[model samples]
Target: MSKGKFSSGVDLPLPVNAPGVTKQERAYQAIRDAILNGLLQASDRLPSTRVLSQRWGIARGTVESVFERLQLEGYITRKVGSGSLVSAVIPDSYLKAVTDTRTGEPDRNESVEIEETPVRQEGRYRAQVGVPFVARLASPLLIAPAEWAAHLQRAMAAMKPEQMCDVEPQGAWVLRDQIAQYLRKHRGIDCRAEQLLITNGIRHSIDLVARCVLKPGDDVCVEDPGYPAVHRIFEKAGANLLYAPIDNEGIDLHGISDSAECRLAYVTPAHQSPLGVIMSATRRLELLDWAQRQNAWIIEDDYDSEFNYQSAPLPALKSIDSMKRVVYCGSFNQALFSNLRLGYILAPPELHHRILALWHTIGRSVGVSEQLGLAEFMRGPAFLRHLRRSRQEYQTLRDIVLDTLMAEAPGRYRISGEHAGFHLILWLSPDQDEDALVREAERLGLMLQPLRNSCREIDLPPAFVLGFAALTRAQARNSARQLARLLH
Candidate 1:
């Protein structure tokens, strides 16, 4: 029989005595280890401090201190009605360590089945439309600032032998601080270093958030004709998917209201994915209010926000989130080179610990060397100069493409999403099927993505996405001409 008496509702193990560790530290470590080892799964309610104190023969303050520490570390979460519960952030290292400890001398399979791979038919025509000009692009891959290179070299040289092996699962503090500052100044999203989770790219950030917030069978709402990659992520996570309609003013929030099943929604309000429509300020507020009312989470993927040409980019959803219902995500892949693979998420203060734990579990932290280099780049004078130059260059190329297409194919297509990002949308006439047009364009040596490709099976349109960022003015003009010739 246990020595402690607990309230009838409170169920917990009697805390064991620690030989050398303090009671609070012992309790903290025990709970943390339980969570890391999967002994305490997500949503598992924790015992009250009073019960724990009674069980351990320690003061209630010590147990309270333990709970506070665990909460701070993101290993546990506290809600108004629900006491402390084990967080959903699974430490990947703990799982790996567990697997290594298991009896692993498995019997080898005698025969492995070989599957036949499907062969792709060769296309006769290949043009430089809607595709990155990787082959024709200049050397060194990306034209990173000289200061970035210098900082990277310095970081590498300064790394000690053991430091080299240290896996910075939370990313470099210097870079995280710089990113927080940059977001505040440029995007109007004020965030602390602790609230920012550095990731390899937008996709990784999306994956981490999904893993932490969603369980299998949970429904997630995404914009119709939204980012295809996000759809893939949700599907891979076994989420029940829902779609909100999109229009010139951005996502049709009314549709979201009609669906009561979804607890999560993904919106690209700065520039709607594939469509290029910006959500109006009124709509943005409405959406936020709706999210708060429903106790739903909104993931704001502000991709390609830096290249706004028509007007200053509107403040991100995160910037105005008083309820802390929005998770703002962004990437530098579009602004810089796609290969850079750097992105970040600004989570709510409540989610900071869980997200960090998720980061540690997934081992998905951005490279420390690259993070330091990026920090230096953003801090140095060269980064702003590069942004200004790239903005001008992309704007010029965008204009050339739009001009050529409008002049040559006037009534054939309607342009959208030219205000920001490297990509634009060309809405084809109802008479032309988008996939057929794409196939025809390919036959004429042009590679184009059908806008319908970004949509779900039931929702599609006769349109295509054209990226102009990586292309030169001449290339844009030529690609536009080729597209016109193919369509007309």
Candidate 2:
């Protein structure tokens, strides 16, 4: 009497009892049940709509309707050439079946092989460099607003159709406009949106610039104890690196000019890496003049200039670049999160199209959704509010760190470069073994860096670069205590 069968293969439910259910509905329910009951598996192709229609004595349109319903319900997936397949949503009973088959133990219901993620332990003390924890922490913690999220969601939904087709090789124009406005307001670098070429991040931006400008084995001047990653990138691009030593003022232009074969120079003039020194206005003018005279390009990495603790943010090297010699690179990696991977290059107007072409050959572009979200974020009132909040936070943390060091270590450590950015360099006594101190500090639950590590060779008068931005005031105090103990 029943058409539906039970586990024992005996008929259970009478098909006549379900009078209102259409034949198409019946087919859809049967296929869905088979999928949920573990009879059909993920990736198992289903019968063609025509075959099923013929076998079940239903119209082809009706079968097509059923398959479409199944697809909408996530019971099946359709591929371009490959036919519809069973979806991978396993029912609770099917999961139980899997566990039962593997161990033959019926009572074990817990999900096996799922390991707990370990908690990130906060270090008591640290002196690591090359990261902008202070500049980041100084900025107010702005969670992306709901409107931003909504914009991203809408963009992503639209991207489904657009992605199936081709996108612009340069980048999304809307994002370029947004970035241009942001840079104009904050960095005072005047440019059209068309001149900007977006890349994966600062490193990728550097690669694009290198590809556009330099040839293999061409000599480029890099600051001594400069960004190590920059050196690697230059080498990979086939450039012979020449060292330009940095002083308290910034990269020594005299040393750079003296290099016989140095054709280009990379400098973090706004705020030097590791040293935390700002290139004075006088030196900046001199460097620009030198570059013009030498017919060389200046790669000004204006990283972390946004969180200037002492004074108003310095004008970027590109701001005064009348000769069109500066390839200005900056990023939200420090201002926002590191993984954002959105950095930009402002090449001279003449080089814009060339860099754009180079970017197209390297990678497609950043994700459409993220670009849209960032564009919306930059236009909003929240961004300005966040910037103000970050400035105060960084300043407070900097003060707390300075006070702690003065109270604890006193004359033992000479603190330098606390005027801007997220860290200060501590020059230690000559007798101290910088490497040994760092290793011992690590064992005692402190993360520190030896000044020598930043150098190509050994450095005299051991020093450490300490970052206080990621830690709270209380955390900074506690870390300072641990550092004081380590030093003593």
Candidate with the greatest lDDT versus the true structure: 1
Kindly list the per-residue Cα lDDT of model 1 for residues 313-390, writing each as its tens digit.
555767656556788888776556655778888776555556767677656546667877777777777666777787
Q: Compose the digit string of candidate 2's lDDT tens values, residues 130-234.
A: 222222232223445464477676656666566545465555667778878877755657777766766767777777877777888788888877777778888
Name model 2 segments beyond 4 Å from true: 1-151, 154-166, 257-259, 457-460
lDDT of 2 at 382: 58
Query: Using alpha carbons, what is the TM-score of model 1?
Result: 0.69
lDDT of each: 0.67, 0.66
Looking at model 1, residue 32 earns an lDDT score of 58
Worst 10 residues of 1 by lDDT: 117-126
- Which pairs of residues collide in candidate 2? 134-422, 138-390, 138-394, 139-390, 140-390, 217-238
Name the top TM-score candidate. 1
